[model samples]
Every structure is written in structure tokens, then in C-alpha cells.
Target: MAVEEILERLTRGVRDMDEELAAEAAQDALANQMPALTAINDGLVRGMNEAGRLYETQEYFVPELLLCSDAMYAGLGILSPHIQRAEEESRAKVVIGVMQGDTHDIGKNLVKLMLEVDGFEVFDLGRDVTPADFVAKVKETGAELLGMSTLMSTTMDAMGVAIRMLQQEGLREQTTVMIGGGPISQAFADLIGADGYAENATGAVREARRLLASRGAAVR
Candidate 1:
């Protein structure tokens, strides 16, 4: 099949939530020497955008969205190895985690995957992470960005505590902070002094780039 046909199939596979087809199409794209980045962006990401639209229209619910995301990631796993990152040796490092007392991670995982596919090296700290742990990781890894997630309104305060810890430890200037999850909002992010807020994985990638650029740092 032609590259266009393969990419189209990949896109359809994702929209249909056919993980096997998406992965197969990705392999075909690789075998045909299609640019992995092209396959990911023009194919999987495009399909995900369509899924997002469907979700907004209420044509697709959480289960369907999750399935679509699974299909997208199936293709991503196949194409990721072939994608050549421009600054592989010094890719921007990002530290991510779910805040203390909150264990939800589906959204956090998706954000990490999207960030990685966009060429950012992510250090995922998993769920229920403490403020000290977040601060220590930034200081230890010298990461340029810190991303926090929480599904509960109660645990939201953990993000603020983490940021304050960073400030007290003198690490705030060296790292940018972004937040997301079920109970988070732009106003809350602003109140917590976050650098940015994203509603979903796609927005997270864009926001991460904008935040990095605003800090005079390179996104890749």
C-alpha cells in the first residue's frame, strides 16, 4: 500500500479503536520507510483529534475515548523506536506525578506518553507522590518542567504544597510547573502559581511547549 493509504488506515484504526489494526498500520508505515513522526502526527494524532471532537459532541464517552487512546498508543509504541529525535542526547527533561493522597493515573499516563512522543524525556513519579519527592526529583534530575496530576479536589492542595517546597528549596527558578486532572481548572492553576494548565493530554503537550518557550528554553 502507498504511504497515504497506510496513514489513512492508521487514522481510521485509532478512530475505530482497533488497536491491532493501528499497530499493524504503524508497522507497515515503518516498513515502507514513512517518517515515524509523520505517521504519529498525521495519522494517530489526527485520529485522536477526531476522537476529541466526538467526545465533545457526546458521540463518544469515557470508555470509547480510552479505547481510542489505547489504539493510538499501540501505534505509537510501534513507531516510537523509528522516530529520530533531533536532540536525543539533550532532550528536555520533564518530571511528572500524581499528587499526594490521590492515586488516579490514567490521565497522567496519557500525558506522559504524549510528552514522550513529542520528544520530551519524562520521569514519571507515579501516583500519590509527596511534595518532598517532587522537589527532590527536580533537584536530582535537574528537570526543566514538573507536571502534577490529581483526580480529587481534596488532594489538589498537594500541588500547591509541592510548588511551595520548590520555592523554599530554591528550585522554582530552575523548573516550570504544569498541572492537570479531573478537578483542576485554569483559575485554580493560576491561584496555585502554576506556569500552565492543560485540560487533556493533547493540550498538555502544547502547553508544555509554550511554557518551555516562555522560559527561554527549547522544547525538544
Candidate 2:
């Protein structure tokens, strides 16, 4: 299959949210018959961009976005190791999670999938991640960005605690922290001393890349 054909097929599946077709597209890429990295990337991520826009415009809700994200991940997973080589580069590493005392994970999960498509190697800490654990992962993985998610006002302080712990632990110099969730705000992030905050998952990815570029992998 030529890159053009591969692109058309893959994008069609993504726009339609057809997981089986997306899988087939992955198989085609794995086969590497046409060397179509850009085609594959655009199909996977452009579909996601559409889904994100739909979510922002209220044309689609969280459930729909979640499903679409799943579809995108399915395709990206098949392209995982090849995405970098085929695309000729790799993005930086990032750690993402839902904060301690917060059980919500849908937002963080979506952010994870998109960042993967964008070529970031994401280490997901999952739900109920403690400040100590967040700091430890930064040390362990040498990740440039640490993304925290919290859905409750009560648990929002946990995000701050994670940042402070990183500082007190003397590891804040190595990691940039970004927080998100319904109850979080830019103002709250500043008060909490987070390096960045986003209104949504897409903003998180954008802010994360920017932080990594300017800070040279240091935050606090």
C-alpha cells in the first residue's frame, strides 16, 4: 500500500471511530510496505484533534471522547516503536496521573493517549498517586514533565502537596508539574506552585511541551 492509500484508509477509520479498521491500519504500518509515517500519524492524531474539538464545542461528551481516545490508542499502540523511527525523531518523556485522594481517571487517560500520538513517551502513574510516589517516579524515570489530575476540590491540595514534596525532597529541579481537573484553575495552580495548569487535556500537552523547551528540564 502506498502512503497515500494507507493514510486514506487509516484516517477513514479514525474519523469514523472504527477500532477494527484502525487495527488493520496498524497492521499495514507494521508491515511497512509503503513507509508512510506521516500518513499514519495524521490519521491517528487528526482524528483525535477532531474529537477534542467536538468535546470543546459540546458536540460530543466525555464518553464519546473516551471512546475516540481508545480508538486512537489502539492505532498508536500498533505504531508505538515504529512511530519514532518512521517519523525520524522522538519527543521528550512525560509522567501523567490522577492525584492522591482523587479516583477520577478519564481525563488523565485521554491525555495519555494524545501525548503518545504526539510522540511523547508517557509514564502514567494512574489514580491515587501520592506526592512521594510522584517525586519518586520523576527521580526514577528522569522524566521532564509531571502531569497531575484531580477532579475534586477537596483533593486539589494533593497536587500542591506533590509539588511541595518535590521541592522539599530536593528533586524539584528535575521535574515540571502541571495540574488539571474540573475543580482546578490557573489561579489555583499558581497558588499551589505548579509549573503549569490547563483548562483541558489538550492544553496540558501544549503546556508540557512548552515547559520542557524553556526550562531545560527543571521546574519549581
* Alpha-carbon local distance difference test for all models: 0.89, 0.78
Off by over 4 Å in 2: 35-40, 81-88, 216-220
Worst 10 residues of 2 by lDDT: 81-90
User: How many steric overlaps are in each model, in order?
Assistant: 0, 0
TM for every model, in the order presented, reads 0.85, 0.87
Per-residue lDDT tens digits for candidate 1, residues 95-148, read: 999999999998898788678766788999999999999999999999999999
| Full-model lDDT, candidate 1 | 0.89
- In model 2, the Cα lDDT at residue 18 comes to 78
TM-score of the candidate numbered 1? 0.85
Clashing pairs in 1: none
Query: Compared to the true structure, candidate 2 yields what TM-score?
Result: 0.87
Point out the worst 10-residue segment of candidate 1 by lDDT.
82-91
Candidate 2 C-alpha error for residue 88, in Å: 6.0
**lDDT (10s digit) by residue, model 2, range 17-130:** 777787788788667654445645667777777777777788888878777776776786677656446455655778888888889998889888877767688899899998
lDDT of 1 at 90: 67
